[model samples]
Target chain A: MTRVRMDLFVSLDGYTTSDPTPDDPMGPDWGRLTAAYTATRTFRERIFGDTSGAGTTGVDDTYAAAFFEGIGSEIMGAGMFGLHTFPDDPDWKGWWGDRPPFGTPVYVLTRTAPRPSISMDGGTTFHFRNAAIGDVLAEATDAAGGQDVRVGGGIGTALEFLRADLVDDLHLMVAPIVLGRGLRLWDGVPALDRSHTVTTEVAESGTIHVTFTREQHA
Target chain B: MTRVRMDLFVSLDGYTTSDPTPDDPMGPDWGRLTAAYTATRTFRERIFGDTSGAGTTGVDDTYAAAFFEGIGSEIMGAGMFGLHTFPDDPDWKGWWGDRPPFGTPVYVLTRTAPRPSISMDGGTTFHFRNAAIGDVLAEATDAAGGQDVRVGGGIGTALEFLRADLVDDLHLMVAPIVLGRGLRLWDGVPALDRSHTVTTEVAESGTIHVTFTREQHA
Candidate 1:
């Protein structure tokens, strides 16, 4: 069976963004929050498209490699798709440029999803919908084929699926920093531990990796 | 040199107490939050006085042992001293009974502090004072001689020293569970990461131990 998985970057204090605005989306300390993950070799290759083989290896790299592995489809919110940035522009193809990182079917859940699915370079196709999260997940699950369906969060989208108890695997890349300000994750869903078997590990660079896997899926 | 150090129990969401009341002190999920620590051999020997050597050893046990070692004096809030539980009763020597946990001078910082120091059965002496935390720490430092001064927290007390940058070593025993509603520990202390060098480790039982030791002291 195909599993539903997600990976999120947060500080030790469980913050994602700091006083985020539409103009400055991720805020000032976004780099600090994602310092460890971005330092990984896999991140340098996958996200940055660096062919020079730069960035650190080992624990953080292993997790970074797993994030991009076996993911056939992705479901994200308007923010992640960059719909909020250029809502009026018909040519807005997200922040990932023409050659987007995800080489799979990407579903953008928004109230302002234009009409048709836009096919882009690098085997990527953007599907827009305003349907309920469960309905969207069903479509994404089907589109994933035998591979895993990944939830690409702006955090809000992921939490909605998480609160509904749909996510099978969740990994939190916790930076060894205290962001006393910003988005507070895990506010309402207190059964995180009860629903999943959690395993935590510390990387050499002080990044803490915490994974919660649902028993049936495991 | 005498160093100021502290160890606190918090959830992954950085919560200490949840919906706490005078009747139900630590709230409903206190037991669940402390499950791993309580399961440790050192905790069983120290806190429960279970000298039968009946408890799990290793990662959690090592941390539990360290919590009780190399500490000459302790400073805490009135709530931690059980003054809030039995305020009217003059003979109430705290919930720990006569042989309290700390075998050192335990300073109780309270506004309604009674006159004269009360010496207990053990090497423990309850010193009540309405003085500022810095002043109290000075006295505690003096009383500690060359040994470390430990700040025993009700969280609020700990944060006070933390925000003031008085603590040299801060160790957080982060339970794998996330308590959605509780006392938010790192609410205003954003500089916790900036001031100290952080290191995270995971125990076999899934309890995460994160330590923040000041670089100057290190």
Candidate 2:
């Protein structure tokens, strides 16, 4: 069974954007956070489809190499995929242009009906899944080839999984900022009794990295 | 004429929430950020409806107090008003309880037919408006009685006003977080020739305060 994990950066105040969207005002810090993930040669080559300038060396790069090593496939919510309405037209690819960042098979959960899969460079393909969360996770896990399944979030999708206890390991990088208002991460979920045991904590120049594993209920 | 100013705290890259919704792994910093705002008397009283200990003595407190002092009316997007579907139910008040933060009139912009105004405690009333952005701003300004009109956002509504160039002053308190995905502010707006002059920049305990005034175009 592939363990599902989630990795993302958030503000101290639980907001992701200052204007209800994903654009944050903290520039270099945000770049540093992304650099942490993009620094890894394997991760970069796989996601960006560009092997040039591949062997970058940095603290974030080293950590990113380790982070991406275990992931097999990814599942992202419709909102995380794009701001445009789901069942997007054929002309509308995504923010990542013709070559998206994810090289592996990606499943986008939406309310739309079945559509043809989108193929991009670097072996990346996008498949829209309108089924329930459990079915989508199962499909992603099977496609992952015994590797861990990663839940790339848009807050709403992450909550859906959390409510179903589908996520296994969690890694969150806290940025020191606050969005007074926007889409909050935990706005509507019912509280759960599960406890998280901190596995690791690291403070980098851009963000504070913390990893948590859900403890088994007594 | 009343100036419409929007004051908000954003990250360097321009994200408003750590996660798009309120269910991701928001760490301990969330509490700290919430405390930063709740420490302010105006914010506290507006959201929680508790007027106890509402005083501006410290420098941070003074800045927050002055920022929210003279807002006559508020304009919010459909998402910010409530999660309910528009033109479906007129009874859905909002996420906030009976007494919302704003104690004046609130105009909610939508594409559907307008609903009758619903009065609330503390002199707050909710009025649904399906008019054009200019019309809504005009109505809000007229209702403001010479006081500044505060434009509350959800992303869609904020961009509408920014694209229309109806806002006079924009205050963004840059927090130090980045959400790599979600609704982005200024996403689809065309690049304009307008310029903004920084009026003030302050670094508080947790966030940086920056104010920008749009220069009048000839």
TM-score of chain A of 1: 0.96
Per-residue error for B190 in candidate 1, Å, reads 3.0
Tell me the whole-model lDDT of each prediction, alpha carbons only: 0.86, 0.63
lDDT of 1 by residue, B1-218 (tens): 88899988898777987887776677888898788889988988887889999998989999888888889999998888777877887777777877988999989998894757889877999899899999999999999988999998688898898878899999888888877788988877746877888889989887889998887853
- Cα deviation at B26, candidate 2, in Å, is 13
lDDT of 2 by residue, A1-218 (tens): 57888876665445544343434332334453354455556666666657686655564455566667777889988767763343446555556777776678999887765667888976678888999999998899899999988898667788788667677776765543433444455344322212555432333334445455666522
Q: Which candidate has the highest lDDT of all?
A: 1
| Candidate 1 colliding pairs | none
- Compose the digit string of candidate 1's lDDT tens values, residues A43-127: 9999888979889898999999999899989999988877777778888788888888899999999997465888889988999
Report the lDDT tens digits of candidate 2 across residue range B186-212: 444422223545433333444545455
Model 1 lDDT at residue B148: 94
Tell me how many clashing residue pairs each candidate has.
Answer: 0, 40
DockQ of 1: 0.71
